[model samples]
Target: MKALVYNAPYDVSIENVPDARIEQPNDALVQITTTNICGSDLHMYEGRTAVERGKILGHENMGIVEETGPGVTRVQPGDRVSVPFNIACGTCRNCLSGWTAFCLRVNPVEGMDGAAYGYANMGPYDGGQAELLRVPHADVNLLELPPGTEHESDFTMLSDIFPTGWHGTELAGQQAGDSVAVFGAGPVGLMAAHSAMLRGASRVFVVDKEADRLALAESIGATPVDFTQGDPVEQILEATGGRGADCGVEAVGYQAHDQSGQEHPELVLDNLVKAVRTTGGIGVVGVYVPEDPEAADEGARHGRVAFDYGTFFTKGQRMGTGQCPVLRYNRGLRDLVIAGRARPSFLVSHELGLDEAPDAYRHFDKRDEGWTKVLLHPGQ
Candidate 1:
């Protein structure tokens, strides 16, 4: 099998690896057709996380089930499915309550409640970036796609960013006719803007410095705010008639940067607090770890940011932050794709074979021009 393996900081390679096979009674073996290189993967690629070398580096995955364990009854060979990045056992208390991201039974680390494929500190599960992948708790974790579903590129997003983007809007309590200010125009942030528009937002403002990304956001009818030109908060406020947006979304996470391109761990949080109206809600879908040994400051190294909690409290604003539980939203989002209401593939800027994954990682990691998103087709 050929797969992308993390070698070191800013380095990854396509190397021959052992074939993935079902290791548990409830597992299924999937022949991966499409996988993605996520922005979160860049955290590990940049040496910001403690991910081990030789680990396969993909999480957004979808494919056809090649085989199933004896215990798997819901799906069988030849069935197409999308594997959520969060691997959950259906019997856990959190899973039963619709919080699959916090499932208590997946992570091997004691006291850790969540797990993700190819993610640092998540679990021992290998990702689906290769020709094959093993899916644990197959019946519960694999979303069976509609028969003959041909939108592989679009459906592939259901595994992570699509649902995650929808979750952001849901967390912000966005209502029809409301205005939303989303910080960051990365794939997830763009998806958040698309979700906001799909849900009837009166106005959507997407903030970022990249001209291409901002243009993509504007293509979807979102007002683009290039922070490099001026204060993003002021720009958003000006667009919102000075009342501030009805809601704000933080999609840039811990790697947020200021106008000068310096890493400011709390930049998005502070910007969201000031950009959202009083009593409005804020949803954060960005990845923020408890520790980043490569952080620019001692406080951020421990995952502590100097946020404006005093101002947030005074404004009576509410905030929701965490990983998105794909199970809670993937099905509905998938239907939206099936019905042609959404087209997430528009974010995919590059489609490469499995062999090109290493170079793709480097290009995407640099946030290079025309590299908004990269989708890897293992079967290509």
Candidate 2:
């Protein structure tokens, strides 16, 4: 099988690798039809996040079950399914409580908190960027697609980004008639704004420096705040008449910016704090790590970044952050997509075959040339 192999910093290429096989009794071997190249993958590709060389690197995936273990009962051969990015053991205490991302089982590299396929901080599980994927705990991990659905292309996002965005907005406590400011206009940011609207937000201001992404935000009924032009806090405050937004979702993670034109992950949260009204809540879905102490770039640093904690505490603002419990929210998001209430498919800007993954990595990692989201067709 040909899989995308991480060779070095800023280098990934398609290389022939062994075909995946079922290794556990509860596992199912999936013939991957569609997989995604996520922004998180870029963390590993750029050497920001630690991952072993030659490991396959894809997580947001949807495919067909080719075969299932005898213990599997929830799904069977030939069923279409979406695999959540987290590789969790279904029986763990955390898994039972709907926190699959922090499952006590399925270690990523080692220890607890389990692992993710083809992810930086995730365990040794191989990714689905290849022709096949071995899905452990198949019964609990696979979400069966609705019967008779044809356009599985868009629904593929249910594996991660869609549910993640929805979860972030939900954490922020967005409600009908409330205003929101989402920092970042990337795929997740756009999805967050879309989720905010689905919850009936009165007005959504999406702050981004990218013109194309901000335009997409406007097309989806969100007000685009170009962060490069001026202060995002001032923009949000002016837009909200000095009361600030009711909720602010920080989608940009640790690579945020401070007012002095310096890049810092904590800057994003600070701006969010400055933008939202007192007592408002914040939801963060962006990736921030406690790993990588010597990260050369500002975006790839550890969790100890500086932020305005004093201001946040003084404002009495609540905050939520971490990986999204995708399985907990996948069903409702799928219903939204099936009913046309939400269309995450609009985020896909480029579609390429597995062979084109190297170039895709470069464009997406650098965030160059209108590359918002890149989808890889594994069997193409």
Candidate 3:
């Protein structure tokens, strides 16, 4: 099998790997058709996370189930399915409660609570960035898509960004007619803005310095707030008549940068705190780890940044932070795609083959022009 393997910082390659097969009775073997190089993959690609060498590097995945174990009842061979990144056991306490992201029975690591494919410290599961993927708890995690490849690009998003973006809005408690200010114009950020629009936000502001991403945000009916022009919070406030936005979403995560392009771990958090109304809610869907050995800020190296907790407390704002439980939102989001109410494929800027994944990773990691999102067809 050919798959993208992470060797070191900024080094990934397509190499022949062992074939993926069913490892458990509840498992299914999927022939990966479409997978995306997600923003989260950059964390490992940039050496910001402890993603081990030789690990397959993709999570946003969808494909045809080539085979399934007898224990898998819902998903069957030849069924097109989208597998969520979080690999949860169906009977776990957290999974039963709809908190699939925090499933207690998946991660083998003693202290870890959840599991994911092809991620650092998440689990031992191989990812879908290859010709085939072995999916455990198949019935619990596989989302059956329409039989063919119609909306292939859109259905591929059901695995991650689309639902996670909607999770940002859910955490922020966004209501129809309320205004939203989203920090970062990456794929997730753009989706957050788009989700806000679908839910009827009166105004949506996307903050980013990248001309390409900001333009994409604007194309989605969001007001673009380029940080290089001025303080993003200030720009958002002015647009909201100085009252601040009714809600805010932080999609940039820990490796966030300032206006001058210097890395600032707390930049987005501070901006979100200041950009929303005093009593408004904020949702943080950005990835933040306990430590980053390559962090530009010394404090961030130890996962300690000077967050404005005092200001946050004074403002009486509420915040929700964590990974998105894809099960909670994907079904509805998938229906939105089928009904033509959502088209997340609009964010995909490149469609490359599995062999070209390394270069795609390089360009996407640098935040290069017109590289908002890159979808990889593994079998191509």
Against the true structure, whose lDDT is highest? 1
Cα misplacement distance, residue 334 of candidate 1 (Å): 0.6
lDDT of each: 0.92, 0.86, 0.92
Q: TM-score of every model?
A: 0.99, 0.95, 0.98
| Residue pairs in clash, model 3 | none
**TM-score of candidate 1 versus the correct structure, residues matched by position:** 0.99
lDDT of 1 at 350: 92
lDDT of 3 by residue, 1-380 (tens): 99999999999998999999888899999999999999999999988898889999888999999998889899899999999999999787889999999999889877778899999989888888999999999999999999988999999999999999999999999999999999988999999998999999999999999999999999988999988888888888888889999999999999888866788888899988998999999999999887789887788888787889999999999999999999999999999999999999888899999999998988998888999999999777
Worst 10 residues of 1 by lDDT: 144-153
**Per-residue lDDT of 301 in model 3:** 86
Q: List where candidate 3 sits over 4 angstroms from the true fold.
A: none
**Candidate 2 Cα lDDT to native:** 0.86
Worst 10 residues of 2 by lDDT: 293-302
lDDT of 2 by residue, 80-174 (tens): 88999988788889999989988787883565475788876577789999999999999989998875436566788999998888888888988
